[model samples]
Target: MTEPRTPKWRALADAVRRQIEDGTYPQGDALPQLKPAAEAAGVSYETMRAAYKALESEGLVRSVKRTGFLVLEAPGRRRVTRDTTVTRDPARGYIFPAAARPDEPWQVHGRPFRALVPAPAEVARHFGIEPGTETLRRRRVTSPAGEPPFQLVDTWISPAAVEDAPQVAEASTGPGGYLDRLEEAGHGPIGWEETIRARMPDREETQLLAISTAMPIVETTIVGTSAQTSRPIEVTIRVIPADRVELVSKLQRARTARWPVAPVKPT
Candidate 1:
């Protein structure tokens, strides 16, 4: 009697791994044709394709139509960063107002607006604060000027500064944006610092962000403080897909006031 056959897809993936180890398909070598591999492995074309998918998930090979599978030279993670104007447009000569509150959880066009919960432990540590602290968390999904949402952003702010303002407290009932509240409270943030890092997403984050399991994430942690006082007040963490979204920060120099001195009397 003939021995039972192994699953075709798993067998194919094993063959590719062997090729890598033996240098038959050295780093950066093109993968063997799937059709031919199917024949060689005594597997159907569909099963062979499934094998390729497995390799891709392991970050072993990349496939592009007409390009076949190419072994990535370096097998490591990646991150992307872009400098965008704070305002809608740089030429407009206007600063982008700070995000103050959560938008109504209604659909704009077909896509629903987003919101965020308070900071988790790692996020809270970035801001030098305790977790579960009373902070304003905002979330939003933004699309290109005329496209579907390609990016998601979540930010956190302390209530210490804005609690006195009715509009700030009312965010729970309506749309609450941060910059607006800051302006109303007489202590608008004039400066900020942003720290970003690349990392893999956990299962829960992957579901919430709605990203592919194969993709990585870039996390941006921001600390916004009062420009006048130069004191830290709020810290925020935003997770973005590595493929989408760019972070831009433009800082202006603070001007020193020139106090007028009484003219000295000449003897």
Candidate 2:
């Protein structure tokens, strides 16, 4: 007796999974379009969608609107570094990190807005200054290419840091950005304090982010400190979509766990 044949979509998904594992379809690469793939396979569009959906469920691929089934990421375990804007590279020193791989690189969504504005309460607290103090507010929207904007960053830079590094007040701070300039201005050995909060977005935030009011946002506040004088130098607040990214924190052991042996005298 003949055995039951595998479903067309199931067979297609299995084939794709093999191709993905063998590097035939690398990360950021797109699979064939649904209609075309279905026609080529002599199957319906729904069948093709099922195949792609199966791959998505297995973390082998993802469906992007206006884009075909694209490989989400490479085959490996990934970790995220949720530091302040300053990412340390061995060759580059401190630089702003990219949100996506080279194939789909991150881009500043539009021209950044910079001006001296009254400090937010949290920024004042971090800087140990009076609320409403004037500070340079640098605001920018950023996202991966062809993707909806995911983050809005507002960096509040103290006047003292700007005074030390005049370039920090300029439109461009060379390649390494303000952190490098800050370090050059005798603020070496910089440290960071990060805190996270969650709340519903207001009208402006919802419109700028293009997310629904029902969706909450993740607020990450990073305070950069001068290790020498132990003073806060910069305070950056990042508003991010809650579901888009993973935030990881490193845990350090204060003391090792110990277990006592049973008393010999009792025995």
Tens digits of per-residue lDDT for model 2, 1-267: 999999999999999889888888886789989999899989999999899888876656655568767775532322455544655665446554423443456668879889888987888888888889888888999877666677899998888887888887778878777888899889987888778899877777765765544456788777889976799999888887555666675655444433464445855
Candidate 2 RMSD to the real structure? 9.1
When summed lDDT is taken over every stretch of 10 residues in candidate 2, the lowest stretch is 74-83
Model 1 superposed RMSD (Cα): 14.0
| TM-score of candidate 2 to 2 decimals | 0.60
Q: Report how far residue 161 has shifted in candidate 1, in Å.
A: 2.5
Residue-wise C-alpha lDDT for candidate 1, range 39-116, written one tens digit per residue: 988889899889878876665666655867766443222223344335423232223223211231322223433333
Query: Clashing residue pairs, candidate 1?
Result: 99-178, 100-176, 100-177, 100-178, 101-176, 101-177, 101-178
* TM-score per candidate: 0.50, 0.60
Root-mean-square deviation per candidate? 14.0, 9.1
Tell me model 2's lDDT, rounded to 2 decimals: 0.76
The C-alpha stretches of model 1 lying farther than 4 A from their native spots are: 1-81, 84-118, 126-128, 145-148, 169-176, 245-267
In model 1, what is the error at residue 170, expressed in angstroms?
A: 3.9
